[model samples]
Target: MISSDAYILGKIKEGDGNAFSLLMEKYYSVLFKYGLHITKDTDLIDDCVQDVFISLWQIRHKADSIQFIRQYLLTALKRRIIRVETQRKKTLDLHDYEFDLQFSIEDILAERQVAEDNASRLRHILDQLTSRQKEVIYLVYYLQLDHAQVAEIMHISRQSVYNLLSETIRKMKDFWENAR
Candidate 1:
């Protein structure tokens, strides 16, 4: 089955004006959710989503070279969010806002209950690691990316990716043993 994405992207590059509408129809929700997660501002998220689509339209030729369309979309969204954050920081007072990215107490309690109910197994204990370790683990496992890709994305050396993953896995093993 030809994916709607392949069809729409193909048509879009051919100068079909309506192809953009189809592309937006196929990916808008996915884009919006990613924007919401990154920016945490509904209006800013919407603006970023729109700008990404505009950029995509302007550079449709690069679409074929992209290995993972979702990854490309996410990279674009992330860049847009960063730019917005930088611009906002120049004028807005951020002192009133908390930078807590953790889940709420209610959410933690609910997750704990679910874990206990399920006799939950820690298939991968990346959550217990430091931020850098967690990023390495997530890039390697969750994103199914190679060490090279992880290193490139994280702006570190390939050897550093290997080192971080080795340490993270060892820590996970220790954490699991302690938990048991």
Candidate 2:
């Protein structure tokens, strides 16, 4: 049996509007949040995400080889955002923009006094990481994507994903230990 994602892709390739709607409903917010980490412009993010879906629908028949819809969508969205940002560079100083990953303690922690402190500490450590490291950590742990999926989404080698994840974990561990 085809997995739900594959089934959705198949339906989409067959021009099933409902399947495309389901795909959008499933991934729009995720793409938006990921886009936020890449660029601070909300309008750009919205437009890029919309473009990704529209492009996907247009190329659905050619997307039969896609095994992971989320990874494919994320990769396309990231490329779209980067392309838009590059175009904007003609008018704006690129240095003014930063690809910072915004994390919220409330998103990661339960409502407990002790957990709040731990969450804050973790957030600080996360903020200390390089943008690429933070992106790897977010994709792997927060999004629950495997190294292969992360590698695909980030357009990096699987080995690079492993290295980034391991180094980020090592840094976080050292910070946690030193804090104790």
TM-score of each: 0.59, 0.81
Q: Please list the C-alpha lDDT of all candidates, in the order they appear.
A: 0.63, 0.81
How do the residues 3-31 of candidate 1 rate in per-residue lDDT, one tens digit apiece? 66677777888767798887787667876
Segments of candidate 2 deviating more than 4 angstroms = 88-98, 104-124, 175-180
Q: Candidate 2, residue 25: CA error in Å?
A: 0.8
In candidate 1, the residue pairs with backbone N, CA or C atoms under 3 Å apart (3 or more residues apart, or in different chains) clash, namely: none
Residue 26 shift from truth in candidate 2, angstroms? 0.7
* Candidate 2 residue 17 C-alpha distance from true site, Å: 0.6
In candidate 2, the residue pairs with backbone N, CA or C atoms under 3 Å apart (3 or more residues apart, or in different chains) clash, namely: none
- Among these predictions, the greatest lDDT belongs to 2
How far is 131's C-alpha from truth in model 2 (Å)? Answer: 0.4
Best by TM-score: 2
Tens digit per residue, CA lDDT, model 2, 9-125: 888889999999999999999999988988889999999999999999999897677888888888888888777777756653322335577666663355443355666777777
